[model samples]
Target: MAGRFDGQVAIVTGGARGLGLAIARRLAAEGAAVVIWDLDLTGFDADKTSFRPASAVKVDVTVPEAVTAAMDDVRSSFGRIDVMVNNAGITGPVAPVEQYRLEDWLRVLALDLTAVFLCCRACIPHMKAQGYGRIVNVASIGGKEPVPGICAYGAAKAGVIGFTKSIARELAGSGVLANCIAPAMVETALLGQMTPRFVEESRNKIPLGRFITAEEVAAAAAFAASPECSFATGFTFDVSGGRATY
Candidate 1:
């Protein structure tokens, strides 16, 4: 699997850092010409990376126009989009449903669920035209387990899982596969948003008694977004450290 992506083009949304960055790096290492889409380019340093990406474009995935423009840029520059990793998202305020604000909920879904949809909608045509593609959407364990105090985040991620399932069904026998990754609180900047108690309680829930790492997630994503993963679609690759068994 060393050069699983050689001669292919891959796009990683919100890939400037954290889980996205890790996945982007892995795809590049496997020989994919990786391109990242993010509002911030602070964490993406081409020269400092082990596997330098083809480019990092500043695109706000939440905006349909921006996403379309960026996809065009990628296609114009790289020729084809072989893989798309929807990794951009945020863990909305850690508050109970009763305390959650409507604005916060809207914001969460806009980036988490809606953005995934927009990116998929924008790229599927390109992939369909080429007759081959792999779509790996980053979901969360909160979508599987009923985690309280984060209604928006949980609901949005659940939507991603459901959305991915439908995408796979629609693309069946179409040379394109869609899957999701449900990770249980990986130790990335995502943790910084949570309260100390929130992080510890989540850790205790995992039988492994620890949070998963970004590199571990990247490894799993590499396979899901690789051509080697040809048979599985509408599946969830869990990196929950025993928090989720199904």
Candidate 2:
């Protein structure tokens, strides 16, 4: 069957599990030949699904050299990168600002903020040259509102939102669109890093009375990276499920 992404190539970061994995699968199902960049590739086999990534390359997104090399490899193999999903992230030690460790803060920012920069930096040129591209950064509702204990996470995601806007404007007429998803508390493995009390409190705050799902996020991301998303750049698509009043 023909699909929106037929004959296109996509690259999803941190796709070994959780949100990244779900998004990767969704892109593949839509007929985009996908590539996964992660530290682990155990989840994606050559025949895992009717549509799967052409290659699941092991990558450490925090490292500049590795990200550059991986991006280059994908371009060399596919001739173009139509979609770049910066979905790799970590919620560093969920604690108050005063209790957060310096290392934890830096680590979270490195993976969450800086890695997004690295991937976008590597992809912008290829996209510009082709005159088309979609960069969907997975931000968080915590970035827009206050999530209290997860100071580092909130800060990093806020940066992603701002960064997406900046780049979207920069590439506005250049044929590349940049946007982000600000979803509320998603019950993924990432939740395992948070305190049970913290999780409970977060769930209670949601007006919908439930957390987000990986599949829901994936669907939103797919739209942001689709040709139909042509007019909505520099925007934050709220997947907060009624939690965000703004």
Best by TM-score: 1
TM-score of each: 0.98, 0.96
Compared with the true structure, all predictions reach lDDT values of 0.93, 0.91
Clashing pairs in 2: none
Global local distance difference test of model 1: 0.93
**Best model number under lDDT:** 1
lDDT of 2 at 17: 80
TM-score, structure 2 vs. true: 0.96
Error of 2 at 221 (Å): 0.4
Candidate 1 segments whose C-alpha is farther than 4 A from its true place? none
Which pairs clash in model 1? none
Error of 1 at 217 (Å): 0.5
lDDT of 1 by residue, 1-246 (tens): 678899999999988888999999999888999998998998667767665778988999999999999999999998999999999999988987888999999999999999999999999999999999999999999999959899989999999999999999999998999999999899899888999999999999999989899999999999999888999999999999998999
In model 2, state the lDDT of residue 178.
97
Clashes of each: 0, 0
